[model samples]
Target: MMMRSKKIKLLSLAILSIGLSQNALAEDHWKLFLKNAYIDRDFDNDAVKDTGSWSQAISLFYDSKFQDTPIDQLQIGLDANVQYAVRLSNDKHAADSVLPFDAQSQKQASDYAKFGGAVKLKYKENVLKVGEIWSDSPVANIDASRQLVGTYLGGTLSSTVNDHLSLELGVLSKYSARNDDQFRKLSYTQNGNKIQSDGMSYIDLKYRVNDQLKAAYSFAHLENIFNKHYVGLEHNYALNADTQLNSKVRYFNVQDTGSIAAIDSQNIGVIETVKYKNHTVAAGVQKIVGDAFPALDGYIPELYFVNWNVTGFFKKNEQTYHFIYGYNFKDYVPGLNALVKYSYGEKIKLADGIENNESELNLIGAYNFQHDYLKGMGLQYLFAKYDTKYGNDFDENRFFVTYTKKF
Candidate 1:
């Protein structure tokens, strides 16, 4: 604890020094974001009781360019965040608490902070960076759904090989979860057991076949655990001036590798969406083969299946169907929009050979204030109902008020 505190202080001092040295310049390159959120979750299963919390978070980001310096193509980036959450209610089930509980203290955790930065070198159309980073690759990604976003520590290189093709490669050595203040080795969890790995590596490629068609492929490996491959195709078609149609086909294959052979799965999905003026509608189907989709311990993988909501909807032998409806109220009420989604999964085969089903309904609404005083402020509300045939049923509600400012 003492060592961690010292490191935090040192990082703070370094940031302060940088700001003071370039006071005037830094102002133009810095941004600040603030958010206040309240989340409530209720479970029907007594084993996992209800939980609620109110949280506040602030994030700072800085980007500096070496314009006329010797390293003119180099840039420095810094990001840091502080978050505190207070428990509003619990069902007195510390053993099964869904809140942010500290196992050692047997109580809820209230404070979290992280600091990280990166150095970037730009060469022509290619860039290389090393340090803390976030990715949105289908095979490996960071979850930004919570109050804080996840981060990985390592190096990444992105190259624009040609007008039609682009490539990205990276190696991650450590990970900090959305709620964690410290980084740790990457790991996989199954049945409450965690298997730690040295790191993860990945390669991603994208090609533009035409103006409206694109294809992507990604390969990822979690050291000593599993290898994953993702292939996807996307297409867009303009029906008319005010109408557009989009479609996607995505597939994934996973296999156990190295000494720790513990994973085997395949996932595939297809989706079609059409947007006409203010209304949007979509539908999709997805399936899981062999086993369940495995995530990196507590981290959420970028499962881009159409049926993926709060859950991946990928259990052993599960087949899911999904639909969505959305409306843009900008014509009637500026800066307002809402969407509702539903997903149903059936034929989920548990280890005991019992077949079950699960479903989820989600609704989300948001409004961004257009007034000058609240120009950068937004309000959002989200509600979800998750039900299963033989598992815990739950409902979730989240509300957030956010503001972003650049100095």
Candidate 2:
């Protein structure tokens, strides 16, 4: 613990110094962000640990671009950021949390800092970045649903092949997800061998079929760990100026490579939404094939249309369904919206031939201030309940407030 603390202090000091120098160099423009998050949770009698946390984070960023004289079409840029977070007083008892700490989350649950710098180059429609950077594609995304933003150390490239097609490529080596402090090699944590240089390479392509239809595919190879392929299709149909219909379908196939072939899984899902005036209604369903939808992810968001609030219905042979209703109060009260969702999953296979069922209900209300000084401010409240036949039951409440301003 002492050695880790010292490392954090050293990194923090170095980053602070570099950030101060950068702020001086970019006197006219620099970015600052402050964020705070709190989670309040109640568990069933069987749960013995606390499930609450409070975290506060701050970050400073500087980015600049210049065109080289010799290469008129080439542009070079530098991007740097320093970020730090501290556990708030409200979460002092989180040391005994319901879930055991992962290496990254353990470090982030205290006062810790991270520094990142990236060099970017652009030629025509192609852009490349090397070193520390951030990317949030659907299949591979940084975990930013918490106090701190997720970051990666490696290289990535994006290019527009033509008017109808685009491509993305990445070779990421290390990253620190939202709750983690120290960056670790990007890999699946559930592996028996805890630490492996699990470098990942991926390529994604998007093609536009027309003004209302689009399709995309992404492929990833996690060195000796796993392989994943995802394909998605989306279409929009206009019923009228005030009414429309949208549909999306996504499919995922994953398999383990190397010595471990346990992560094999497949998921197929579709979602449809109808909008009329200020009201929107949506419904979706997902089917798990092969084994369970294995959680082979760095930071897994519900890429599927049916996965909602609590769990993603990622159990063996499970099927999930969800419905969401949203109302936009913009017609009467601008910048106000509310959503209610219900999700259910069943048909989960157990080792002893039993079946498990799970469900969740979520209520959310959000408001964005539009006044002069508070124009960028926002407030939100969310209440959720999760029930399961096989695992612990829980309820959660969250409140969020945010504001951004440029100097």
- Top candidate on TM-score is 1
State every prediction's TM-score relative to the real structure.
0.91, 0.88
Deviation from native of the Cα of residue 229 in model 2, angstroms: 0.7
lDDT of 2 by residue, 1-407 (tens): 68548856876786677666665455434577776667677888554554666666667776765446478899887777777766664433444221124444542244666778888899999999999868655557665555667777889999999999999999988877665566788656453544355687899899999999999999988787778899999999999999999999999888888644467688888889999999999999988887776554445454443464555677788888999999999988999999999989999997788999999999999999988877767888888888999888888877766665543
Which ranges in model 2 have alpha carbons more than 4 Å from their true place? 1-30, 90-108, 189-197, 297-299, 302-308
Cα deviation in Å at residue 72, candidate 1?
Answer: 7.9
Cα RMSD to native, each candidate?
A: 3.0, 3.5
How far does residue 51 in candidate 1 sit from its true spot (Å)? 1.8
Candidate 1 local lDDT, residue 246 = 99
Largest lDDT belongs to which candidate? 1
Give the per-residue lDDT digits (tens) of candidate 1, residues 304-329: 66566876688998999999999999
- For candidate 1, give the lDDT of residue 20: 77
TM-score of 1: 0.91
